[model samples]
Target: MFIVMVAPECAPVAKAGGLGDVVFGLSHELEIRGHAVEIVLPKYAGMRYEDVWDLQPSHHDLWVPWYDGTVHCTVWFGYVHGRKCFFIEPHSQDNFFGRERMYGYDDDALRYAFFCKAALEYLAASGKRPEVVHCHDWHTGLLPVLLYEQYAQVLGDQRVCYTIHNFCHQGLTSPEVLWATRLGRVDHFLAQDRLGDDTHHGAVNPMKGGVVYANFVTTVSDTHAAEARYGDSACGLGHTLHRYQDKFGGVLNGVDYDVWNPETDPYIPAPYSASTIERKYLNKEALRERFMLRKSWSPLVAYVGRVDEQKGMHLVHHALFRTLAAGGQFVLMGQEQKHNGINGHFQHLKDHLNNNPDSHLELSYQEELAHLVLAGADLLVVPSLFEPCGLIPLMAMRYGTVPVVRATGGMRDTVFDRDHGEHADDRRNGYVFQHTDNQAIDSALQRAFGLWTDYPEDFRSLMLNGMRADHSWHRPADHYLDIYEHIRHK
Candidate 1:
């Protein structure tokens, strides 16, 4: 099978969050399974070239359609982590994708719009057609629309699959921006209910466009798919998803063991496995030292993610204080959202930690520190209001760190509650809370702390079980392959 993945982010080279890990991990897994895989991403400024293999220029030139006119762009080629990569660069004063960061620009809609057209232009110009084109998130949502509209002739019978990593980002833009796609007038799509944004009337939503046109759609987890269709976490696309329920499904995102495994992870100071679980404490001491904490044997609880309200940062803050009162240590590694006042909250955590003996707070995203914390911490916290298949809990599990997560989305699917023991005795991985309230969080923490304090053997058992669980890409990749074959046959 020939597969092409189009995403705005890829791990190790260009990454913001789990989306990057998913793209790079899935592509690499597919290629390892004997399928030819290629990934298309915009060549953003300051992207580390050292991460790309045999990085060089390509003769491929693209004429990307804009609202007013078409702009020329140069296409560069490279191999990232064994998968073929295409980096498109637009030469215009607009400076699309020329920023230091991958996202958070006012003109993101325009930048990604240009990227979508340029990607197809490159594929058409290069005369390469894969059996399946897998588009990830809203950043590449327009690819499916472009394929069916403008490039159908050149890319014949190429099935498109769109995966919604985060439904919160619908890529909504003004209807006039449709002119840039060269997909004909937007009125027909709007009138026919093909590319409409039900939440915002008369707007052009690229995600909705992809949903309406793509052969199939997938979210990060089966539970997340259900939520998007029937639950409150749909991000205002429930009607569209429900209408296309048969064509929409969820597949759990897999953890890249090569990068996250405690036994071989290069980032962590000490390599330890389930059998050598005591070695994990050395990493704990190292992490504490790195954060300038007084060495102690207290249970360490850590949180690793964005400090947004949706992630239940407020609840996490509450949990942190309670944990400290209970004599348990806490460490947080996250960045604040702009204008969200999370910076002040994080500062408060830091101030509390300054007086506390074994507490630490880092107001940034440090991948190396993340690994060390996962390896070191006795428990990882994720109290999300509504998570759509989170990866942090799974990563923590791989490190033998029991996850304490709110029962939502991927966290609900992945983390089996040790208290309930619903699954096999050996498979109960972590603690799960039903509500995001302070009381619910306290109950979970009490259970976790009890296991760590009085039942050391049981705590070790839970951690070892989580470490031995299968969270790798092998099964998920096979699921994706099945989806591709179904699409191709249909």
Candidate 2:
């Protein structure tokens, strides 16, 4: 099987979030299974050239159609972590991909539009017809649209499988941008079931267009798939997603153990496994010293993510205060986004926690601290209002840290409470709260703390069960392979 993955990010090279991890992990796993995989991404100015091995020129002086004109680009080829990677660089005159940041440009829609067009042109010039064109998120959503509408004959019989990593960001742009694809008039996509969303009247929804054209649509988890089809979580694309219910599904995102395993992690000071779980306290002590927290035997509760409301930041604050009141230390590792007003509140909270004897908050992204927090903390809290597929809880569990998460999306599918599940003794790995409120979070936390302090044996069982659990790409890779084969055969 030949798979061409088009996405905005890839791990250990040019990553903005978990999308990169998913792209790199799935592609590498597929290649390891004897399938040829090639990734196409934008050559952002900030991308480290040193990370790309055997870098060389592949295509120079490539031209792609933009709005009413042609944009010249140069394509670079290299290998990142054993997978063939292609970087499309738009000409300096266009400046589509010339910015230092990977995203958040005023002309982002145009930037990715050029990328989609250039990717297809590169494939056509190279005469490469992949069996599966796997496009991730809205960044590459228009690839399916372009392939189905404009370059159908040139691209040959290629089936596109579009994965919606996050539906909230639908890539809405002015309908005028569609001219760059040379597909047709804006009226062609103005239909209710197509690119037109009721909220944004004059805007084009690239994700809705992709869902309408792609052979298969997948979300990050089964619960998320269900939510998008029937609930408001789809962000107004529910009509399209539900219309294609037969073709829509999901696969839970997998954790890359090569980067997160406690036994072999290079970031954490003390790497301890389930058998030698007693040594985990050394990491806890190191984290306390590093964060300048009080040295005590009390449990350490931790949170690692963005400081935003979507992640249930309010609930986290509520839980953290409660944790501190209950004679426990709290360690938070996160970065605040400036545009979000709630971040200012988080900054004030960070300042207050910094002055406390039993709490510490670092307001920046430190990958090493993230690893150490997961390894050192006794409990990891993920109180998300709506999570597609959170990796933090899984990574924390792998480090023998029990998770206390709200029951939603991947957290609901992955974490099981020892007191609630049918086979509690054998299946439970973490604490799960149902409601998305402070009371729910407090309940889960108190349960975790009680398990740790009163029932030491059950707490140890939960930790060891989580450490031995399987969150790797082995099963997810097979699931994706099945989806690819199904789409190809259909």
The candidate maximizing TM-score is 1
TM-score: model 2 vs. ground truth: 0.96
Give lDDT per model, in order: 0.87, 0.86
Instruction: Write model 1 residue lDDT over 362-429, tens digit each, in one string.
Output: 88886777899899899999999989998999999999999999999988889999878569888899
Write out the backbone clash pairs for model 2: none
Q: Please give, for residues 1-490, the per-residue lDDT of candidate 2 as tens digits.
A: 9999999999878876678889998888888789999999998888867779998889987888776688778889999978799999888576877776787777787778778888999999888999999999998888888887788889888899999998878788887677767765888687776777668887888888889889999999999998888898899988788789999998999998878898898887888888999888899998988888889878999999878777898888898899989999888877676478887887888777657989988877666678899989999999989999988888888999999999888788899887787755767899999997778888888888988889998898899999999999989998999999999999
> Distance (Å) between predicted and true CA of 32, model 1?
1.1
Specify the poorest-scoring 10-residue window by lDDT in model 1.
184-193
Clashes of each: 0, 0
| 10 residues in a row with least lDDT, candidate 2 | 92-101
TM-score on alpha carbons, each prediction: 0.97, 0.96
Q: Residue 423 of candidate 2: its Cα lDDT?
A: 58
The lDDT leader among the candidates is 1
